[model samples]
Target: MIGLVLAAGAGRRLRPYTDTLPKALVPVDGDTTVLDLTLGNFAEVGLTEVAIVVGYRKEAVYARKEALEAKYGLKITLVDNDKAEEWNNAYSLWCARDVLKRGVILANGDTVHPVSVEKTLLAARGKGQKIILALDTVKNLADEEMKVITQDGKGVQRITKLMDPATATGEYIGVTLIEPEAAEELADALKTTFERDPDLYYEDGYQELVNRGFTVDVEPIGEVTWVEIDNHEDLAKGREIACQY
Candidate 1:
């Protein structure tokens, strides 16, 4: 199966650090950045092909991918989302539309993770379910993080951005294993949502799916080590997590 890494975000939160580089290339643990860690983990999970959506500092992302290929012989496909500046992550995700079918493990390039997380998510394949990693919020989450609201146990009733401080139980890590058919349906819903409202974010896609009566299987990871490097402080914490991984 193909692995898709959503790395095309402009990373406005990362600011000056991302002024010259993409957040995925930010240094973590000595040499391994989120980009490297993500690709390496996918390789360990038995994914032979990877498609990465790149935007900011796209050349640097390409160079890193080339270096990884030389060192580990990974086969990676790079797709550029030219609208990265104008669109959100859903745009980056759509860049890999052809590869996202039939349950590919989709990850955000800004998250640091242990290789086992990759294996575990990939194992969700063939379960005939739409699986999204349900991450326990270690601390207070911000407005941009996707929060999974559980309903009826074992089901995700809604996945939304922090609408209010009272709305979230935990965060939704970008790591997800979705069946191809489910993804296609979600993509169509996302397209409709976007056509109606151009400013819709990625979480809106999940909300739309949930509203349409789709069951989202939650794969809970009780702090197995993952970090979303949304800011400089987050980057520091992500570095520590990278070392442990």
Candidate 2:
């Protein structure tokens, strides 16, 4: 399976740093970027081919693509999402539908996490589940987290940020294993999700999959240090824990 990264968002909340570079390129450990860590993790798990969806200062990615490839010892594919600055990530992910057909271990470019999270999802493969999300059962949920709810033996019942945090089973950590069998349906679901609302998140597409009776399972990444960087505070937190990883 090839590694897929959603690195298309503008991350407007992050100002001057995002002015010239994408959020994924923001340095967390000296010169190492979030994307650097992601590529490193993918390489650690033996996924040497990667596709990155890029937009909003995509030139920066283009400029560093060769260097990153050489550094990670991997082949890189760039998936362009022209609407990344205007729309949310559902469309950004949909832009990589063709790459998804190869089966993918998807990581959000803005998240900083260790290879253990990737290993957790990879270990859960071959369990008859088409989609397996990295769920953090240990983190305390809040309104901003993409919360999940699963039924006993029924896989995921719901995943949304609007849900009551008190009822959620865990938070999806933005890493997912999408088997080849689920790719086409997920692409369709993502299409429907974006067409319905241009601002919907890709997590909503996962919800669409569950709404259509698809079995979406979760693998708990027990007590891992991870951060999804959205703003300055999150970036600070990411920098603090990134060195540990």
Candidate 3:
């Protein structure tokens, strides 16, 4: 199985730093970047090959590719997403559809969390869960969170950003385990999503899976701190949470 990372977004909210580099390259723990942490986690879980979708200052990733490969001891393949700046991540992820058909551990490049999240998903693979999302079932729901409504807290019923916070069971932590079986179907769904709207998020792909008959399950990382770097405040939270990792 290869590791897949979506690091194409420009992250305009984080100007200056994002002016020259993607958010994944932003340093959170001293000089360690979100890309570093993600690759390190993949290494911990024994993922030796990784595919990264890059855009919006793709040169920075190309410049560091050799160093990143040497440090992580993994073969790196950079996938280009020309629409990364023009569209949202549904297209960014669709750009990696060819890679996703293989089993993969996918992590958003701008999220910071511990390696334990990787361990959790790897362990849960035994349950025959084809598509498993790392969820924070204990965190307080917010409007900005990618919320989920599950059936019996086991099967995902719906996942969306527009859901009312009061009805959400938890937040998807931007990490996922996609088995080879689910990846093909997921790629199709992502295509349908992007064709429907260019601004849709990949979370919308999860909704597409649910709309069909596929079951998308969850692995709750209870009380394990994580932060999605969206803005300056999230970056602060990411820095604080990253230190604990």
Best-performing candidate as measured by TM-score: 2
| Alpha-carbon RMSD to native, per candidate | 2.3, 0.6, 1.1
| Model 2 RMSD, rounded to 1 decimal | 0.6
lDDT of 3 by residue, 1-245 (tens): 88999999999999878999999999999998999999999998899999999999999999999999999999999999999889999999889988988889999999998999999999888777899999999999889999988887458998988989889889999999998888789999999999999999999988998899889999888888889999999999998888777
Model 1: how large is the Cα RMSD against the reference? 2.3
Q: What TM-score goes with each of the models?
A: 0.89, 0.99, 0.97
Error of 2 at 128 (Å): 1.0
Error of 1 at 109 (Å): 1.3
Give lDDT tens digits, candidate 2, residues 18-39: 9998999999999999999999
Model 1 is weakest, by summed lDDT over 10 consecutive residues, at 130-139
What is the C-alpha lDDT profile of model 1 across 16-99, one tens digit per residue? 868877888778888777888888877777777788889988988877777777665578889998878787776567667777
In order of listing, the candidates' clash counts read: 2, 0, 0
* Candidate rank order under lDDT: 2, 3, 1
Model 2 residue 125 CA deviation in Å: 0.9
